[model samples]
Target: MSLTTEQITWLTKEQISWFTKKQTQTFTKEQISVFTKEQIQALIPQQITYFMETQIPYFNEKQIPWFTTEQIQALTIQQIQTFTKEQIHWLIYLQIQALTPTQISVFTSKQVLAIAEEQIPYFNKKQIKAFTPTQILTFTTKQISAFIEQQIKEFTPTQITYFNEKQIQTFTKTQIQALTKEQIKEFTPTQITYFNEKQIPWFTTEQIQALTIQQIQTFTKEQIHWLIYLQIQALTPTQISVFTSKQVLAIAEEQIPYFNKKQIKAFTPTQILTFTTKQISAFIEQQIKEFTPTQITYFNEKQIQTFTKTQIQALTKEQIKEFTPTQITYFNEKQIPWFTDWQIPYFNEKQIQAFTPTQIESFTEEQIKNSPQLLLRKEEIKSFNSKEINKYNLNNETLSSEIKNNSRKL
Candidate 1:
């Protein structure tokens, strides 16, 4: 016997299931539209599967909220594909978990995006792994933003690569922090560009180490600007050694005051030489004080010449004391002029005397005129020519004059 829509809606759950199983495929769209949300929610899993695929899309959006998670879990792929964005958006977290990978695979992009924020993690990474890269790419900015750390790590590199540059830009710092080294290694230059300064510092040390020379070279100056002292401190010597001169110079001058002692110690002198004159000149006095003197031998004369006179004078006596004779030899005559009179007494006879006579000869007339006399003994003074001694502006007569006068007196 045929029942009216009103009567059918009033039927008990058992009767409704029996009637649906027998006639569901034959039901007209108008008849199906009249089924109450309660009747749909009460259907047994087996009976829920009996609805015609064509009719499933007819269910009003409100009907999905009442369907038990178990009923939704029993949906076939064809039935799942029939859901409209409106219906899918209403699925609760429990029902979201109920969507099998087969069902998940059929969701249209809008339907997938409509998945609620709270329900995002229900993809149960296994489901995520099964998603084709194209399907994963459909994730909206908010949808991608909703991913938890573990879920983010499950994204395959190919899936991650499918992210349009704009979608990639939306990753939260927490999600960025979750990135595996292997995953980070696959980040494209375009994707790398979207990272904000605060986001980069969250990288684990291993993640930083895994950055390719290509990727590190791509960092925008602004990204480099926010890498704080501690964040910079986390990098290994090897990791830090990869920065291009431009990249290193892009770093905030103020951020790297410990450069020579800590960050720069890892750099070969050739690498250290890449710093711009301004960058080298920006060294705070504390940085100059703590700088390793042994590293000085690596400086080419040109690099050594960049240190301002003030910086030269700021060098502590102890720091200067570490300068090997080899280190002293690297200084050109022009660089020697930056030292002050106060610094003159600290150079012991060996370090000062290490300069070849030719380098001393290249000294400017002013350098010779003001040069210290006591740093060497009387014999050292005797080695100087009468002209060189005269350049010292000493009170005594010329050495040649002294010799002749003393002979005559004898």
Candidate 2:
């Protein structure tokens, strides 16, 4: 029997579910809009398959979840855009997954944000790329965390820039690792500060290298500690120069040897002073040679003592000259033997005087031969073999003239 539009609105849900496809198709958009929410929800998937594009927008919020996945897939782009935010939010994960990329792209920002967390991974790359930056910002942290790697990677640099700090922190390490270098470079310093220690090390070498100086500066000490040697090696010299003293201290000792000469040289005196003894010991002879004069001067007594003999020998003549008398006195007696003949000449008179008699006696015969300006005290001079002193003419007037010339250079 044919029911009038008025009669249809009054029908029970069970009665509405019994309607044939031909019967449902006969309903007009105006007639559909007047139907009871319960009656609309009762329409079976088979019956709803006959819904005209004109009738699609009539589905109100309360009736939205009752639409089956097959019916949702049938929606055209124009029909999808017609749904209210409340209607969009009511869609189950299955129904959300049914949307074509073209249909998903047409959703308004409000509708896009209304999607549930469980529905987030249903969006394919093209669907994710279609979201505007404004829409991307509307996503809750829960929804952001639910995104799969592919969806996370699909975000354009401009879209990635709009993620709030909370949303940025919610990304899984795998999702973070999936981000393109362009997207990584787009993060602001404030957003960068939100990453936890576990997430920091997941960045690829290229992604780590892509970080801006400001962004690199935002990493907390805990986050800085998590960086791997490979990632540490990727940091540009300019990025290295901007690290705060506290952040510099957080660098892992194992990563110290990975720094290139340029990165090693970029360290400021304040930054150099922050290295632990263990980190100072970790530096290779090659890295030791790259130290700036100011950096060499800043090493604390404890740090100076940690250097290996080979590292000690790697110091340039200018670096050797930069050592304070107090720092020179801190070196181990064993380390005194590592000083080369040329390096010995760079020691100022005060540095020479700072050495203990044992340290002075530890020096090689070749070192004493080249250090014509070295002025040992009576007891310190007694510690060395008289034959070596005589061979080097250590007590001669040439020592006095060499000291005068060295004083002129200073």
lDDT of 2 at 120: 82
Q: Per-residue lDDT for 80 in model 1? A: 86
Each prediction's TM-score against the native?
A: 0.73, 0.64
- Residue-level lDDT of model 1, residues 186-258, one tens digit each, is 8887778777765777777667767777777788888878676666766666656777766777867686673
lDDT of prediction 2: 0.77
Q: State the C-alpha lDDT per candidate.
A: 0.70, 0.77
lDDT for model 1 comes to: 0.70
Task: Write model 2 residue lDDT over 147-237, tens digit each, in one string.
Answer: 9988888888878778887788888888988898888889888788888876887888988988988888889878888888888888888
- TM-score, predicted candidate 2 vs. hidden true structure: 0.64
Ten-residue stretch with the least lDDT total in model 1? 373-382
